[model samples]
Target: MTNTKKETRTVNIDIRKDLFGANENAAALNAETFKKHGIVAIDIMGSVGTGKTQLIETLCDHLRDKYRILMLAGDLATTIDADRVASHGVDTVQINTGTACHLDARMVRVALQNVNLADYQVIFIENVGNLICPAGYSLGVDRKLVVVSITEGPYMIRKHPLTIKHADMVIINKIDLVEALEFDIDALEADIREVDAAIPVLRVSSKTGEGIDQLIKVLNL
Candidate 1:
């Protein structure tokens, strides 16, 4: 059961343009487009190997029966992530960002132009695998989620405070290996609290299916 209607889209993105200024304006327009169709969009960001794609796969597996879902995957090349999720019977759009580090609102609007927006109820955007750049751009989504894995080491939250500050929720993934890796989840959580006093944090393992239900509850999915 797969729908590869819109596999992956590659757009010519000019990074020389005013990224901040242009992106903000375009984000607002994208917001209007989403609201017109009553869609719930989420922007997922994290570093390489942080399991952004796997988390989306878990989410799609959980929500596919309840909602008409679409996944918009942004990557430098290849449609691997989009292909993986599309196998779950969720429609997907791939945004090949050429040289850009993040998926801007205009890129989303352009990728969505060929598809009918009213056909879907939820949109999950998998941004390029970079923590720093993606935090600065807004994709006009209902929430921006940042996933941090214990495999990245404990200093991630401290080193990238702005990324944590920008996200609506923080997901600590791969917690199933916490004891084996001697990783301290509490201290890392303290670091996030230092940056954002009230952001919701969930501990999850895409493999073991732990804490995913709590995360979905927080996301109102």
Candidate 2:
């Protein structure tokens, strides 16, 4: 008697699912680490020229006297942003993501390697400049602030809904140029509201410090 063995089908593994799931777990660990050190971590995400670094500098300047701050700047290759913030007397760790478009939890944890987290009361992580990729990765920060500038044009919000949906707060930056650019500030905010009805939105000109105080109050910094 010939016995035929049962057929077995190959299963396809979803790599993105595995990667994102791993990221979520790593993010949890990072959060616990930050909490253990009594640190308030903030993640700043935005497009390349959206003035994320400038906003961070503004924040560091405002809070440096009140808190021991550390800045982790993520970029593709250069140390430009990190160096810029470091010049502001804020301790900095630059995470060069190479080809990666976002700063993942694992990268942030490794960037803090051998450093005493207890030395810092606040940590600012400037994610690699991108709207989409950074939204998917959580660096275990208390809040993820997305800076969208009028310079980026009006379609930015309507074009990238997921970015707005994932952000804890939406910053309408470059509002100081609203009239000159004829950019409707309310229209941009309307786009954000459409994506996230309850998400707190603020207009701030990091250059002129417009609405910076309100932003700080909202951040509870």
Best by TM-score: 2
**Model 1 stretches astray by more than 4 angstroms:** 1-17
Q: Give one digit per residue, the lDDT tens place, for model 1 in 101-182.
A: 8888899989999999889999999999998989888888889999999999999889989889889999999999999999
Q: Compute the lDDT for candidate 2.
A: 0.93
TM-score of each predicted structure versus truth: 0.91, 0.96
lDDT of each: 0.93, 0.93
Which residue pairs show backbone clashes in model 2? none
TM-score, candidate number 1: 0.91
lDDT of 2 by residue, 1-221 (tens): 99999999999999999999999999999999999999999999999899999999999899999999999999999899999999999999999999999999999989998789989999999999999999998888899999999999989988988988889999989888988999988988999999989999999999999999999999998
* Clashes per candidate, residues 3 or more apart or on different chains: 2, 0
